[model samples]
Target: MSSDIAQPTTATGHARQYGDRALQTLLSANRALLRAEQVNALYQEMCRIIVETGGYAMAWIGIARHDPGRSVDAVAHYGDRDGYLRDLRISWADVANGRGPTGTAIRTESVQINHDFECNPRMEPWRERARSHGYRSSLSIPLRDERAVFGALTLYAREPDAFDGAELELLNQLAEDLSHGVRHLRLRQEHAHNARLLRRSLFATIEALTVALEKKDPFTAGHQRRVSRLSARIARELGVSDFDIEGIRIAAQLHDVGMIQVPSELLVKTGPLTPDDYDLIRRHARAGFDILEPIDFPWPVAEMVHQHHERIDGGGYPRGLRGERILLGARIIAVADTAVAMNTAKPYRETPGPDATLQALRDGRGTAYDPAVVDACLHLLRDLREAA
Candidate 1:
């Protein structure tokens, strides 16, 4: 170390020089913090504001690492660094290397200051570089939250004993503000991640339920899934919004869920159903609505299930909802359900080809089915044929 030592300086002189700039730094950072949406941008701009507005020689934010090594990594920096970090190593351990302002502030959870770089024994390793860079003083203020200290904001100045008691207190308040910012960003990221996980879980559970229904009725093994795919395709072709399309697809998958309550023998009877059996089968739509109403779905799923069998001409089962009174999701599921059912074999009728299904849709476009849905379904089917 050199012979130059920092004597007790006049508090009034240092306070007068930096008081105005310190207040401005705090105000500027608070403004930027209000609009910061990401972590990197928040710290990088913070470093810039501190060095440019606060009149500091250099400023950096160092975050502590505990797993691999007890080292402080300088994540964000502004102003002149001048190779100061190339030969410098600081830790929060109880050793000589951890005695510097940065390390001491982090370890002790308080402000650490080196009023003189050339003569201070704690800053001996940095004296030569500090002298060449015209830096005479350093301040390390801990970045803390409610629980513990996570890092430190290390700053340098050209004047000896530049940071007085008043300045240190102001800097501490700035560090606390940064801690709140970091906490806010972390909570937002965690919430978004959790939302994605919840959606995935809900989808897996619903798909499993649909599969179980398929196993119970072997003749309709993949009927619901096929109707779901077709319903989604028609909705997209009709220019339905993504949100409604998702609801339509989900509703189609579970539209026949009430069939589970029907007797298994009646499902594969291979003959026309008796009046009693027909009545039980007709009650399936209402039964499905009751079973699904208890669960809180994001969409109008239960209502769609209850309305899927209703006709637009007041000629269809359970409740004969006519015209535009039927829900859009229910309407889409109806078209897809009829098309797939006509194509597949059933106890009541033999399987018809795709052309026959199209003919049925053409004949009943406005009377039974919604005209727009029929048109969209036809368009999608025609495109697939042309592409093939």
Candidate 2:
């Protein structure tokens, strides 16, 4: 819980400094996994944790780069790195620089350790760089997920022969923890991306259907759009969760979509519809339900559309879904639909304005409309008026 996690003051002497450093490093990685939101930030913090908590002189992470060059790019570093991280062009190719622990770890997908960095033959090329930075012993451990190796974490110690069997074992666990954190972040990002693409496809599909309906009934060109907006507001006012609110909006957007099956002349008819014509007009609800049932929507969009015209008193048509039998989404859409329709001019009647619409809603609070939905609609009307 403490912010200063680098040093845990348990003992007074050299024992506390070196003996407990590995435990602190492991704890630091666990803390970073909780705090860091993404992979790049996680790696950067891991490098810092090794230097500050693990008692290492320096630490850096190198991710494998393909395509233009089969080389390693030092993505994260902590401690004294004037231009060393940028200048060190280590590669997986069988060459002088490639033989070092960093390149070797990446190529072999295994941990590479140099207990004597100054005397090792493979350390000859970058010996001066290592010596100037006070690094005498080094550890290059591959950071890997279950499937494959992604990168390497290179740690430098101040003393020679720093990494014995116990130290190596502890550091390997730290590497594994870092791999798990990175993999979790990548998976989260992939899932978010996929969800966004799926939503886009759903929106486009619904919009196409809405447009087709609007073209058939030119008088109601943007009626569906308005209903969708109102439904979303009403749902939000009712304290609906985000996912269910989207379903309400989508269903409301295509609420009258069954009208596309009716004759075009009947839709634009300015006179009162005959009994036979009214029956045909009402059939659109079932038609819309049939149309939407095949599409795999995450929400119950089809059922909401089918029941949107139903009354709480069981008098309204298309299934006469009464009381609790009607979906909550349909109830919210019902209030939104009536509010919008009453306030807007129709081919058969003049516009009643918002005040008249609210009056009608208040009069029919329970019998015709869901009382909860009506109250939410009333609050929204007041909010809209205040905003205006």
**In terms of TM-score, which candidate is strongest?**
2
Residue 194 CA error for candidate 1 (Å)? 1.8
lDDT of 1: 0.82
lDDT of 1 by residue, 11-80 (tens): 6766866777778888999998899989778888988999999999999888888954588888888986
lDDT tens digits by residue: candidate 2, 1-388: 0011122222334444454787789888899998878888888899899988887988999888774556888888998556657567888656677778887888788777776656776677878987877788788898888777877999888876666444567788888888888888889999999989999998999999999998998887888888899889888988999989988889999998888899998988899879998899889889999999998998999989899889999988887778999999999888888887776666877888767887889988999899999998888787433211
lDDT of each: 0.82, 0.82
Give the lowest summed-lDDT range of ten residues in model 2: 1-10
Q: TM-scores across all candidates?
A: 0.79, 0.90
Clashing pairs in 2: none
Cα RMSD, each candidate: 4.4, 5.7
